[model samples]
Target: MRYAKWTILTLLALTVFGFFHYTLPQHDIVRIVNTYQERQDLDDWTRIFWASPDDQATGLINRDVQFIQAVDADGKPHVYRNEDTGWSWPPYFKFDTANLQTQAEDLKSTAEAPKWVSVTHYGWRIVYLSTFPNAISVRPVEGPDATIIPWVNIVILTFLAVILFMLRRMWLQFRERMIDPMVEDAEEAWDSVDARADQAAAKARGLWGRFRAWLDTWKGRPRR
Candidate 1:
């Protein structure tokens, strides 16, 4: 029993240590990839309306548009009074918010995803820079796209629970098998010992009562 308990404790410690060691790096990579993908999606939508067709027709450019605020001559911070909309730099194509979601997903599907290493500094950074003139494609990873994290968690948890449950059950079965005969033998031995002890206790109590009675009678005797 002691050995089994120690084995279980050791196994638990090993499992915890192994999890941190093996899974942490993979989880980090997945997180970085997901962040890049979401940002790319948002950027792509912005670009569709504003950027001119270029060598990279993905529709990203860095430009600012001036809007006519109160043209009277006051010019009191026209930026605030002016409605902040997409810059008036000549648009390449018609912008449609209704089709933005579809365009975003299409960009995700068609765009060659940069390698994980280059995603943050190169592609993702460029997307951020392009936000001035054009919207980067907004491919917000629709419905469990390109990720297995949740499914992997479920599978691993279920497998571990089953294995541990079976291990515990098997241990219990083995223990019951090993201890049943010993328990039966102890019960028989206890019965015999209990009978003898009960008889001995009765006799001792009777002898004690008799001795008290004799002392009381002697004390009651008259002097003459």
Candidate 2:
């Protein structure tokens, strides 16, 4: 049971960690190499990775998706899908897909004369699943080694920590003030019932013993 409890806790922690890792914004310092638009088929399970830019387009089987191609400081390639989240999960509320695509195009650079830029995005690039991280924003950086401070993630995580701490404190207070008193009262009531039952049993035994002694007197034996 102890092992099972720890296993459950471990799995729960991993799940929460994965959820935050996927949802929270991440940064990649890369040089934009290209930008293009292509028709994407969304009639499969991979649709979850894409966005619903239009409410009416939700039922559509396919749509045109813009993409940005870039390479990291190590010269490794990365592809990001440009889509509007617009009142959806992750809540970036991005509606500037065209503007972002233009920015990516303008920032395009060759291998020798690289103009490094930071791509702020969320999601994962799963090649096997044909899913790309959705790019949120793009901004130029001093160099590929620019130190970007993740202030947004820091604020969000700190706020969440404070909330969890407050909730735990509330739970502890409730247990101390309400639940503990009720439980103690129940235990005391049960103890009193057991005491009464023991007293009744002793009284019954005493009466039966006295009756036996009286019978012994009739038989000419001295009463006990």
Candidate 3:
């Protein structure tokens, strides 16, 4: 039982970690090699990995998705799919798909004179599943080794921590103000019932004593 409990907890932790890792935005410092658009078939399970830019276009099975190809400072190639999140789950509110693609094209450069840029995106590059991270934004940096602080992640985590703390405090206040008082009232009612029962028993004993004394007078002639 103990092992099972630990295993369940571990699985839950991993699931949460994977959820955030896939959904949260991350930074990759790379030089843009190229940008292009291709028609992708989205009629299978992989459809979940792609974006639905329009509500009216849900019936369509295929769409042209723009892609950004780049190589990192270490010369490792990375590809990002540029698609608008459009009022979707990650809530990036990014509606500048075309504009981002144009910017990526402008930043494209060869290895001889590399133009280092930071790609801020979310999702994962699962080779087996053919999944690519959705690029949220792009900006040019000083160089490939330039450091970028994840301010968005820091702010989001801090806000979540504050919300959890506030909720805990509210629960404690509810117990102190409402639940505790109700419990005390129930205890007091039970004590009152017990006191009433004791009084009833004492009154019954007193009546029995008076009856016994009255009966003693009837036995007086026999005693003489």
Candidate 4:
């Protein structure tokens, strides 16, 4: 019974911890990102932004996570929809590229790039392609070259590792607290516990390996 509960907890932890980073419009091959930073406050970790199309005061209520396209005009960035006229955002792909490197030294004085960032531009849209593990903000799908090396997946991997460790600890505690002293025939019960645990673990490992393998093979683009 305790093992069942612990198993459930482990599964739940993996589910929750799996959300290492926010990826929007998962159907897209490339994620859209903010290009012009002077007027934007992108929160890459959550893939949210400080401001939105309407209502820009001094609170977090205006934060938006949707992909946006830059209007060709030099006005403030607006909420671009699929139906918007001219320079509209598609389902995926875009970037803004106003890098802050030469701004500080020049009198033009453009907006500074955020403390941690790696940006790339795709026409009117911007894509944040990568960042450090502990950065506060990042572009949507913009960290650690996800296809080659999924850092967020690594975080989730660590989460699974910790969960496995805790489950092992719990199993040990369960044995010590519930089963060890209770069984009169210690030898037989011990043998049974060892056999059942080994079987269950082996089965779980095989299932996990198969699942991961299937996930890897699911990488190609879907048919139209």
Candidate 5:
């Protein structure tokens, strides 16, 4: 049971970590290499990885998706899907897919004359599933090694930490002030019941002993 409890806690912790990692915005400094549109099939299991911008698009089996291809400072390739998140999950409210694609096109450059840009995005690139991170925004940066201060992420993480701390404190207080006393009272009630049961048993034994003494007396045996 103890091992099972630890395993559950471990799994819970990993799940929370994965949730935040996938939902939270991330930054990638890279040089725009190319942009294109491709019809992506959404009928398979990978449908969840794609964006559901509106109700009409939800029923479609395939749709044209804009893509931004880039290479990072280490020459590592990155592909980002350009799609409007609408007013959906993650709540990015990105409705400028065309505008972002245009921006990426305008910033395209060769490795020799590369223009560094910071691509702010969320999600993950799983090659096996053909999943690409959804690009949220993009802007020109000084260079490949430009020190980008993730003020948004820092603020968000800090806020979440504060909220979690407050919630934990509230839960602890609730258990102490409400649950603990109720549990103690129930234990005390159970103890009282046990005491009554023991007394009743003792009384029954005494009555039986007296009855035996009387029976012995009737049988010509002396009583103490």
Candidate 6:
């Protein structure tokens, strides 16, 4: 039973880690290679990974998604799907998909003269699933070795920790104020019942003793 509980807890922790790792914004320093628009078929499960265009109908099964192609400092290719995340999960509130694509195009550079840019994005590029991270913003950087502090993630995680702590304290207070009193009342009631039972037993013994004494008085007397 203990092993099962630990295993379940480990799995839950991993799930939560994976969820935040995929949904939270991350930065990648890369050179913009190109930008393009392509029609994407969203009739399958992979649709969940893509964001619907800001002006498109939610029920539409197909739409054109803009993409930014880039190469990292290590020459590894990275693709980002550009879309508006207005009023959606992650709450980026970005409505400048077209503008971002244009900026990416303007910043396009060749391998000989690489203009490194930091691409802020969320999600993952899964080759097997044919899904790309949605780019939230892009800005030019001094070099490929530019450092980012990930302040957003730090603040978000801290806020969540505070919330969890508050909830735990609230639960403890509830148990102390509400549940503890009920348990104490139950214990007191049981103690009262035990006392009554003991009193009744004492009274019964007294009555039995008196009757025995009365009978003993006639023991040596004549039958007449």
How many clashing pairs per prediction, in order? 12, 0, 0, 13, 0, 0
- Please write out the lDDT profile of model 3 over residues 15-76, one tens digit for every residue: 98898888889999999999999998888998888887755287778888899999998989
> Which candidate leads in TM-score?
5
For every candidate in turn, the CA RMSD to the true structure comes to 19.9, 3.1, 6.1, 25.1, 2.9, 4.6
- Compute each candidate's TM-score over C-alphas: 0.34, 0.87, 0.75, 0.27, 0.88, 0.79
Model 2 RMSD in angstroms: 3.1
Across 1-224, the per-residue lDDT of candidate 2 in tens digits comes to 99999999999999999899989999999999999999999999889999886554688899899999999989799999999998988799899999999999999999989999999999999999999999999999999999999999999999999999999999999999999999999999999999999999999999999999998879985668
Candidate 4 C-alpha lDDT tens digits along 55-160: 2333443232333222212333322222111123222222221222222112121233222122222122233532111111223333223333445446756898
Candidate 1 residue-wise lDDT at 211: 96
List the candidate 1 regions with Cα displacement exceeding 4 Å: 1-145, 149-160, 184-195, 221-224
Instruction: Between candidates 1 and 5, name the one with more favorable TM-score.
Output: 5
Better of 2 and 4 by lDDT: 2
lDDT of 6 by residue, 43-120 (tens): 888888988646678788888899999999898999999999887777888899889999999999999998999999
**lDDT of residue 108 for candidate 5:** 99
Which residue pairs show backbone clashes in model 6? none
**What lDDT score goes with residue 215 in model 4?**
87
Which segments of candidate 2 are over 4 A away from where they belong? 203-224
Least accurate stretch of 10 residues (summed lDDT) in model 2? 51-60
Give the Å shift of residue 3 in candidate 1: 20
Model 6 per-residue lDDT at 34? 93
Best by lDDT: 2
Worst 10 residues of 6 by lDDT: 51-60
Q: Note the Cα lDDT for every prediction shown.
A: 0.39, 0.94, 0.92, 0.39, 0.94, 0.93
Clashing pairs in 2: none
lDDT tens string, model 1, 1-224? 99999999999999986653333212111111111111233344555433343323333334333211111112121110011223333322324333433443233321134222100000111333343222222323323224435454567678988999999999889879988778988999999999899999999999999999989999979988
Candidate 6 lDDT (Cα, whole model)?
Answer: 0.93
Task: List the pairs of residues colliding in candidate 5.
Answer: none
Model 3 TM-score relative to the real fold = 0.75
Off by over 4 Å in 6: 183-224
